[model samples]
Target chain A: MSGLKNGILVAALLALGACTGNPWDDAAGVGGPGAAGLGAGSALDPQSPAYFQQEVGDRVLFAVDQSSLSEAAKSTLVGQARWLTANPDFIVTIQGHADEQGTREYNLALGARRANAAREFLISQGIAGSRLKVVSFGKERPVEICSNEACYAQNRRAVTVLAGGLTG
Target chain B: MRTYLASLAIGAALVGAAFMATAQTAAAQDGPLRIEITDGVIEPLPYAVPDFVAETPAAAELAREMSRVIAADLSGTGLFREIPASAQIAKINNFDAPISFPDWKAINAQALITGGLSVNGNRVTVRFRGYDVFAERELGTGLQFSGTTDGWRRMAHKVADVIYSRITGESGYFDSRVVFVSESGPKNDRRKRLAIMDYDGANVQYLTNSAAIVLAPRFSPTGDRVLYTSYESGVPQIYVLDVGSVQRRVLSTDEGIMSFAPRFAPDGRTVVYSQAQGGNTDIYTLNIETGQRQRLTSAPSIETAPSFSPDGRQIVFESDRSGAPQLYVMAATGGEARRISFGSGRYGTPVWSPRGDLVAFTKQNKGRFHIGVMRLDGSEERLLTASFLDEGPTWSPNGRVIMFTRETRGENGRALLYSVDISGRNLKPVRTPDGASDPAWSPLQK
Candidate 1:
């Protein structure tokens, strides 16, 4: 039964890979073992935003003061793009956040860059730009509220939140 | 010890000369023994502020309250030590009563302040005189302030500013306001709104509701308008607010760009802020009246947190163009920039001091954040406060002190406001109704 679930998830992700124009681009990590594990949960409940938030993973982390997406971030965003493509009825706002390491205004700008990066990537993956809006909370809101590196890593992220509407 | 001059028996003229010589030496030896300290750190001068004499029944409570505030203002500076009422050796019953210098001297009080108050219906008057008790003379001219009863605290602050300026040789920062972000809610989803209060964190008035997130509230040169970034429209945009009527309008709404970290030029007509476009952020200035816009920095690297010098001829800002964030200065019109900070750490939030002598900034070095200052030439850098998370520094109006936000680390962490002197003394937490950050001190009240 597990093998069948893994097969189905791999097939779906490989279909997503076919949407891309370049085969040499292994940056998305499509059809990998990670995809099988992510398929274990209720992959996509078309009716539930909670399923999209919890199962699809709402956020992606970035390196210190960086808005560029890492390979791991790209892989997670691939999953997000797939889910967002499936749930076209939902409009999402991507909130970019930063660690407490930089100044307030700089962090705000960095957050904006991060959110834009995420928004642009989602759009590239066939999600409509109008469906994805972006806002930057800067260092104002931190998921992990510690000053040390462990927490800073988690705090530097861009999160996609569903505004919850069937029609925009 | 007395000096005796050797005199000839040439007459009374010679005798008089000898007497005058002896008297001159005696006067030199016994003169007022006053300490004229021009500068440098010394013990806080001890002073006494007896309750102000109330000339009418309506003034009784306000008189005491005014004196209390005056004492708090002086003592709060950490430059003057208030001799408590318990330590008072004598009290002045009349506003014009002679100061008992001997009593003050006996108690080691270096200065004394005597005040009188009168209230009739809606009007109030405060008369105050500062005395250099040891020198046995009134220090500076006695002054009186008149205002409505509702504005009694402002009158008290003005009186204190007068006294503080007379003694400290620098202008006072007590009669100023601070605009900051008030925060609440859980860590992951905190809410922030723009709020303004006195320099001492009193008279808090919320300028914007918390329905949307706001960051970096800055005061206009005249303190009549506030510039802040709000996410009310689901995107970060700058909004200018009239502080008096609470009316607000979007300052800039360039298509598909995020603008934040705004500051008013010294002239108050133009504003400088950071706007992010196509994943690139830079600084821009806008004329409020004519709606003219100018791009200050076009670097691919991020450039934000721009502050104008008091003279408005130049601007100091933080940029990551040097690979790591560092302080830089450029002409107000924007051109080639000269790097100002060569330190080993990341430097940001460079706010030029109103005095034009130093720029206060936040530095992150070796896993610690600090609030620090440096001269305009990028020399004499001094870190004032060090902690896990200390950022967003704003200069006091007189440029004697700085207030910034410091956040603690944990799952339940929160941000608090703090102020410290430029001399790196008297670090105190500013009292707020809730968590606060991004403090911008307003110019001295008119």
Candidate 2:
């Protein structure tokens, strides 16, 4: 039942993306003569952080009380790894979070495990370990505030946040 | 925070000529005024505290306020009920006057408390006595206390503590404080600051600003220091703060590793906390003075929230070694642990009671969270509360009550502090200016 609902939600999001003129679909005709011009830092630009977040997906969700990565999560991480490699000047921090179903201390440890899993996968995909740092917010920070499983699924995620100027 | 009042001056000699003999022997004979707290249903012993007599003109308001505070401290315990002064047939106009036993019996007041207050410049003095109306004798020795006028509330609590101990035969928890994380803002972007307040949620003082996230503030054995986890360095690290000076320093736990759930040992010099490294979390003990470290548990699964028994002989903690979180007991020095929670649920955050009789914990079973207590052997588990989310149980000084954090469900959910007796009775919310969580009760003040 949830899978069917998720499919509908994804289809609706794609329809909205088409209306917004998603740049990934227009990238093939970009830079050609008389083609629509796109700014370098705009969300439509493939090399921008905005594009990485919207098109490539910066976050991956997890199951309840489990830190192991799923197949869909791996696919998202692959895109994240490629973006990180292409933009070598940016350093990323993997923020791991959990739902409000567990104790505070245990959730913290679980978040750490999730962030470390993402960090390890990125390293395996040819990204330097030095450019990747991990921090667990536990259940303290949630993207969705509802108490149902849909919100919890969105809250239990690891996001790759990029910052300019890599010190290392 | 209020100028740090001087230590209370306890009068040495007993007062009142009616103190013919020690009330301890009389109480031992099973008087009609006794209350057995372990009973299934308590009647709430009826007690009365008339407005204390003001010996000086300037002490009239202070006397009345102090009397109210004393009555509140006693009635808040859920074991006693305070009869209103309007219900009293005999008014105490003089502190030293002989009590009218028949008038008190007429109102069905089993216990009576009388007090006198005097003010001289910045110095204030209070004297109080407890009585058993049925026996027509004093319950305990009359006592006197002297302190600055700013400490009037604490003086009242001291008097209430004495009366409570004399009647219940157990130490009172009124003269203690609680350290917690004060929260504000919405659920998604909540801000947390370290805060300390009196046991009854009075005199709240913020120890740290909300610039950084802080969690699990714990008081030292002497209530002079607090240890908590902060993300000031962008990673969770334990920091110890002196309560009086408000000065803080982070304990050294290696860089780039997450350390949290810090708790002070009974000796006050050592700390036990969880450290996460390489995605594996384990428990470790660190000595504050020597910078020495000891690995208490090297389990592959999560092991955290370690608490020491009052005797400092054993430690109770939570671990997921059995594929799910459960309570475990091991020596304070470290070794093989014995699993103590056999029930059908996941358990974490086990805190040993100060009296060394039971361990309080948070259990999540069938989608509901509960605050529960169990015997040392894991037998006779009794849940005190059930809510959408309830965690982090901290014991009162006397081990008769447990305070925990309860968060409501939905987008507008917020955390609040709630306390309950060990018998699963008297559940009520503690008032805080903002949202609060992670409460740690301090030992009784010296």
Candidate 3:
């Protein structure tokens, strides 16, 4: 069942890539298309961290004071789980975050819940629990700096940060 | 008038009477000089503190500085207004001289503080007195304190505490310390270090370096040790540090579990804190010496920020069992809890006042945050301040004042320590070397 889901996910990604002509175009927001300068091993490479972070979406956003995964967030996590399965040598740390709308202690716990939610989803997708670790930054780290819902929506997120290399 | 004269004679003869006894006598008289703090909309009692008399040449500067600190301490409460020396109708050149009632009354000074300072090599002695200027009598017995020259500020605070206690019939918070997380850098990558300072933000001493992230430094009941959460081990863990030695050790817990929001019980032997495991959080009490842990709350919702009541028999904490964070009170050992906050928005960081009658907390409502206080039964909820982000309130040793963190809005937002009276007045910023938050006030110094 898991293999069949991956096959269809890969087929959909390839069809989407063919339509865009450049698979790296969707990642322009990270730092333009070829910023990594890796050439053949650049963000254009499907297995690269840049591709996972940008094209496949490394982070899932949450609503204000919420930790339950949204449908959009689940879709992104499914892609993340597929990539993790393909790259078994990479150990990923799921970082949960919250907006500045809550207390310091509550936000810390909320961030943990969000990160755990993402971790559980990946585990359900057959990723080994040992290959994943979770941390909650709470509201300490934010990708954006505004005070409105726009910035808050971005801050309340769980990002899968990949660590270690293909040592195996 | 007869009772006032009799108490005045006792105050003069027993110059060393316990402050509580003297204050009680004055309070029993129901003198016009009393400032009823519970009464709303108080007109600040105008008072004067002329430069203390310098008996020795080396004491001149110290005398002047101490007098200024005393005046600042009294006026900072917003209950007392200092009448500047420039407006004083009389000069207090001699500490033992009879107070010129007519001169003080002419300047509308309702109360007066006069003192003398003497320095002998490294030793310094300060003697001070408070007077009901309009009554033409001393407010309390004169008192003297002796300490080393390096401890002049503490001696000054002692004087102010005595004056405050005498006038208001309540213990003073001036002679206390606060341990807090001092922050530097930007919003995302802030560097935090544990720092301790005088309650008035003087004599700051960094307890830890900014090498790791630290949050919520809480002072022990005796103020000699600090409890806080540090990420030095790559995860949140509770640590206790001796303020005098600056040495610390992590509290052992089940591996991989996160612990934060630690508070020392009044007995200083046990700590009530929040522990998270398996994506669920709950409150737990730990015996610091024995390493024994007891689960306090088994709710599926988040339960953290537990504060012990002054008597140590009860604990007040924040929980989201009702779907949004609110204040709840339970036995120190924990079981069933009664919700103490029924407000519209979320409430968190509930700190029981040292007085044990009120609990201070951070409230968020309608997109604005407030530092508020509510009674034990969840009645008489009063919001003291409103801002973009205001949370984590710590009470003064006296419980009359609350110090909390207030963060600005937007990209350049920074957290700063601010304080307000429980009556919702005299909101002011506490000076720090840089951005600061999560203030935990220590009990009055011994």
Candidate 4:
């Protein structure tokens, strides 16, 4: 146990300790769904107390309403897959986001599909399926705000956030 | 929130009785004599509403303001016009005074509207009457409306609606309610809750607490109930609320799915909504009365924004079945889904017209969003608005107009409610107390 009295714990150490308990608890957050979810846990876990502290790698962007990864996006993702492969004890989350042109729910689904597409591509690139996760903010998180195509292009992106550090 | 409404800035003064002071001075300001009955099409009744016949000097201004508000309320709708209080050759003395119908007819006035208001302890009662000079019979019986000292303006609009309905044979659109999401805080962390207000955007009443984010609030066919989606339980879920008592209950919480975008079926016993599960969403129907749910769609493609036809036989929804979001229709029983949207980059949030004639939806073509309506078969697509974001079109009870939320794109985002007639003649913003979205116009309350 790393309960060394006066040592300051890095976020990776904290996340790794939290992850040792359960993955669902890591995802579900405090008062979120337990392992037996749906009804056993509360309907909403607004704040994830057990928030992930995965190291962020390279980012990926897509075209408007298009989740297809560009060459640059693919190359950056290659770098991400390499980093994830080196950190064998870590699990990663892929968050997909879209610009604000589409409806809220549709954007959410688009984000989900985009995240999944990214995760699948990573799995194809040698990352273990269980080591990867995905979430979609839909149009909720717009990195750009202009009405033109440029802003939307920047917003339609898949971000890889890593968590749970490997230990000896 | 109604209690909070008790504190908003009260608008215009209640109308006072018109008193016949002098015919000579009043006759000098006659506006115009425009009255006609051509081809069996009855035009708005022309009236010479001389400032109310004020009996006391203090009552003179209240009388004038009341008459002006009345004329503005009527003629502002492009319906009626003032024949000038001066046009009345024979002055009608007072509201309850004996009057000869011939005197008003002599000036070619088709209708006469007069009101008298009495101020009591912190309250006012407006007594208004409408008469059809052409038919020589009272159009709407004399109506008495009581309001707080500040609610005189609403009482006045209510009076105008009574006259409009009594003469036009159509239910009054005024006096109805609009329920929407009130936004506060920064754009990134918006806190939204359900709010109800008068159709004119007066007397905003917050219905739900801001403990959670609420979205897509749809009014029940009856004004007393509201159907909306809440994020209270982490997952977005639908809830039905009693507008009067503010009592609420979760409508559908099936397993791990998220239910949102709810609208009542015509029967009011059931609601159609989109349930998201496993990264996919499909339409589902919930019998709120019996706690039963029937899945209407089984496609892995995203199927959402389901709206039932007026008769509940067919459904119009937005689906990504065509590789992009497009409009589609199928039997309410879920069979033979036909693609209805052809000219579009992406379309979502389709609401069937209450008249059973058309479906309104949000379309994103060439990266710009537009609010458009098409026939049930997706034949005639007419885009009503083009903007950064214009979604969630809710129709007036008459089906003549559709109102939707419009959010202007910028670092500082602002969402407002706007309405456009199906004819596209009247495109106006519905005034709201704060930033508003997901406005559902309630059916005209009886």
lDDT of each: 0.80, 0.85, 0.83, 0.68
Candidate 3 has a TM-score of 0.89
Candidate 4 positional error at B424, Å: 0.9
**C-alpha positional error of residue B168 in candidate 3 after TM-score superposition, expressed in Å:** 0.4
Index of the highest-DockQ prediction: 2
Clashing pairs in 3: none
Candidate 3, superposed: residue stretches over 4 Å from native: A1-45, A166-168, B1-32
Residue-level lDDT tens digits of model 4 in A1-168: 122310222222234333223333222211111322334434333222222212222357778667677786676677667766766777776777788878976876777667777887888899998887666667755545456675566568776665566222
**Rank order (by DockQ, best first):** 2, 1, 3, 4
- Model 3: per-residue Cα lDDT over A1-168, one tens digit each: 243543443344444442212343222222212333335344367887767776677888888888899998889889999999998888887878899899999999999889899999999999999988887777876655668886687678888877766321
Question: What is the C-alpha DockQ of each candidate?
Answer: 0.38, 0.43, 0.32, 0.22
In the predicted model 1, the residue pairs found to clash are: none
Residue B218 CA error for candidate 2 (Å)?
0.4
Task: Evaluate model 4: give its lDDT.
Answer: 0.68
Alpha-carbon error at B380 in model 1, in Å?
Answer: 0.3
List iRMS (one decimal) for every candidate: 4.8, 3.3, 4.4, 4.3
Identify the superior model by TM-score, candidate 2 or candidate 4.
Answer: 2
lDDT of 2 by residue, B256-290 (tens): 78999999999999999999887888999999999
